[model samples]
Target: MSKTSQDEWTLEIKPVSGWFHFHLKDVWRYRDLLMMFVRRDFVAVYKQTILGPFWFFLQPILTTITFTVVFGNIARISTDGIPPLLFYMSGIVSWGYFSDCLTRTSSTFITNANIFGKVYFPRLVSPLSNIISLLMKFGIQLFLFTCFLLYYWMNGSTNVHPNIYILLTPYLLILMAGLGLGFGIIVSSLTTKYRDFSFLVGFGVQLLMYATPVIYPLSALPEKYKWIVLANPMTAIIDTFRYAFLGAGTFNPGNLIYSSVFMIVTLSIGILMFNRVEKTFMDTV
Candidate 1:
């Protein structure tokens, strides 16, 4: 081939040396592949299911009812004067998105090994696609929550008070997505070497939810125990989300700042480790 043709045909593969090096530009170049993966994830999940996407609505509603009965009535946990249904739904929807992203993305390496070995694309694309797919599900559940909010509003319930803080919803989601994607890719990378870690992800996420302020308001916790929950990066996001929509729970700017910093650090580390693992994961996986 001529010099120009040879240059056009040449493909260079370089070893990743430094910890901080990431080809984000390359990932952006393959955005079409990312979208394809997202479509596949969204469609494949509901393809054979009877209810299809309706399951998204059903899952949260049923869980809310169960929580209202068990936690609200049985345990008598305070909802900070907000209605029990709205209180639990707010926490549920936020927690559900974060958990779904974490759990699904954590298995990217193992689940997509066949494709990874067969073709070349940004390995991060799989997990990123999972995050996008979960966002879609979160939107549907959020709509359901809004419907309930409107119902309570029309009923003239003075207890349910939404405020300007509700504007933080987008930022809250970005934080959650960062945390989930960060923690998830880290776990996914580790699991390739030790399969035992896979079993713990589900159990660990369940335990982590209780550690977050999902079932009860953060304000209800005694002062001594408050710091323990605050240590979790998710606690602040969930607390602020509840406070914004329902006008209940602690809304500390300091906590939100801490959570944001934690997310950035975790995501940076996660991407670093993910880059290292992707180079050799196929061999061990």
Candidate 2:
């Protein structure tokens, strides 16, 4: 072959160095593979089931009903004067999206070990695809939440007061995705070495939700300890979501800024950890 033709066939593979060195350009180059993974993740979950994608709506609805009965009716937890159904559904929808991303992404290495062992693609594709697939699920639940919101919104008896802050919904989702993806990749990197992290992820996420004002409003939290919950990045996301749609929770721009900062820092650190681990995870995993 002529030198020019030989150059066209050449492929360079180099070791990645540095903590921040995630070959994001490679991820973009593999966008087709990413979409394939997304489709598989979205479809494979329900392919064998009778109801299929309907479970997306059913999961949040059933969760909201359970929360209404247990926390609202039985425990008498305050929903900050908003209707119990709307309040719990909002929290469930928001928290469910974040948790889904985190839980699924956290298993990227282990779940796809076989593929990783044989593949030359960017490893980040698995988790990134997970986040995207879950967004479809999130959209479905958001639609269901919107239906309930419209009902209570039109009804004077419910007194649901949606405000201009509703515009922040998209921003809230970005924050959730950031936080979930950041935390998830970090946990996943750790689990590559320590199998115990795999066990802790589900239980830890459940406990974290209770601390995040999902079942109750931040307003109901005791005054002195409110800062503790506020320290949690997800607290502001949940609070802003409730205030935006239901007009019932604290909505501090400062809190959202805090969350933004938290997301950036966490994601940066996660990418650093993820990049470092991806190089060697197959050995530990």
Candidate 3:
């Protein structure tokens, strides 16, 4: 090649500088890679399983049944006047999506270290893909919840009352995705150096579920202790979802606003930390 032609070629590779160099545009440019990763994640989970995608429906169904038997029937926990089946199913479906995104994406760096080491694509793609893939799974589970909802509604259940708050479903989903991706990447970034955080994630998530009122309504909490549960951002989400669908839970606009703000802050901090870590994570990983 001529010197002039060689001079015309340019390819620059440099270390990420700023704390917020997320390269979101690069994520857009590599949309195809994002989708590919999404597809791989979605299929890989159930690849060799006998029931395949059917497990999506099966999981929530079984979980709701157990909650109904253990919490509703045995312990006689209050579901805020909502039927056991519908109440438990609603919380299961909502929390399941958020937790799945959190758990799966928390391993982003560790699970895809080899690829990150070799590839030039945006590292954000990995976690973003996880959110997308999990969204698909969440959709399936939501459909199952909807079917149960329809059955109860058609059966003339006096308690079932779908309200205008249902319109917030899409916005509520975004809040879930944002919170999960934010927490997941933050933990993933930390796990590069301290593997203990990864171990804590599972235990922490389970404890978090109990704190978030998955089995009982927020109203069931003691007045003094209620503030503690209200402090959890997910508390508003679960309650709002139930209120929207079954019209049987507390709904405070102030709480929802608090959650939205929390999501924004968490996501901003998580992305900055993630961008900072990706630059030197190979050394630690």
Candidate 4:
């Protein structure tokens, strides 16, 4: 028997670890595919849309407006005397980024199984590229948030001025990426065996936003429920973001430690499981 050209060429993907465990070189080799995927995500996502990237900006804008109207003006949720717009926007900015990552990461397996089955690249490439694409979207939305931030900053809202914590903004970005990827990989791995995950992801993320402090402050939570709410790693991430932007939030050092530990543990597990799944997931998925 003679093998054809496609058959003769082998997929030589292998897993590596340490700081370089992700096989950066192999991922770099697939950079074109990564760029194509990013373009596909950007264009295909809103292909029929009139607004295009503006819609990305609008999502958090509309959300902050509704929350300002419903939860802020109507419900009179406390914002520590900061403008209702600023308070809600901070939460919206962080939540939008975190949730976007979470949703995108969660679908990595089911959404791209066809690509994985046909080709061999660093499996991490898919999620990593997705993360980069997501960051682009987040950057757009953050610009929208910044407009409001500047407005309030000029109005002297809440005695808030950007402070030392603001310097940790990059860490907050990494925190959002790590948490989303970690949680998403776990969900994607499970969904391979039990397909209930796809359903859960939609409703679950909505519920999680309320469960988090996206529209409300951690200061307003009932004493007992505060612990449960802050237990979410997004809690620290969001709080830190708000603290950085508005100079006010419930960002305890202990909470940051909790989130850091949780993210590290979950990300390690995610990589281990994803590596294991890359070998066999297509069989089940």
Best by lDDT: 1
Candidate 2 lDDT over 37-94, as tens digits, reads 9998887999889999999999999999999999999999998888999999999999
Residue pairs in collision within model 4: 16-21, 17-21
Clashing pairs in 2: none
**Model 2 backbone overlap count:** 0
Among all windows of 10 consecutive residues in model 1, the one with the lowest summed lDDT is 1-10
TM-score of every prediction relative to native: 0.95, 0.94, 0.95, 0.87
lDDT of each prediction vs. the true structure?
0.93, 0.91, 0.91, 0.82
Clashes of each: 0, 0, 0, 2
After superposing all C-alphas onto the true structure, candidate 1 shows an RMSD in angstroms of 2.0
Name the regions of candidate 4 deviating beyond 4 angstroms.
1-25
User: Any runs in candidate 2 off by more than 4 Å, and if so which?
Assistant: 1-16
| Candidate 1 lDDT over residue span 1-285, tens digit each | 245754575566767566776868879999999899889888899898899999999999999999999999999999888999999999999999999989999999999999999998889988999999899999999999999999999999899888999999999999999999999999999999998878889899999999999999887889998888989999999999998998887799999999999999999989999998988898899
Per-residue C-alpha lDDT of model 3 across residues 163-268, encoded as one tens digit per residue: 9999999889999999999999999999999999999999999999999978999889999888889999998998898899999987899999999999999999
- What local lDDT does model 1 show for residue 19? 76
Candidate 1 ranges beyond 4 A from true positions: 1-10, 14-16
- Model 3 stretches with alpha carbons more than 4 Å out: 1-11
Candidate 4 per-residue lDDT over residues 1-285, each given as its tens digit:
465666666665445333324455777888998898888777788887898777887888888899999998899988876788888988888788888888888888898888888987777778877888988888887888788788877876656766778778888899889988998888888888788987898899999988888888788889989878977888888888888888776668888889989999999888777777767787899
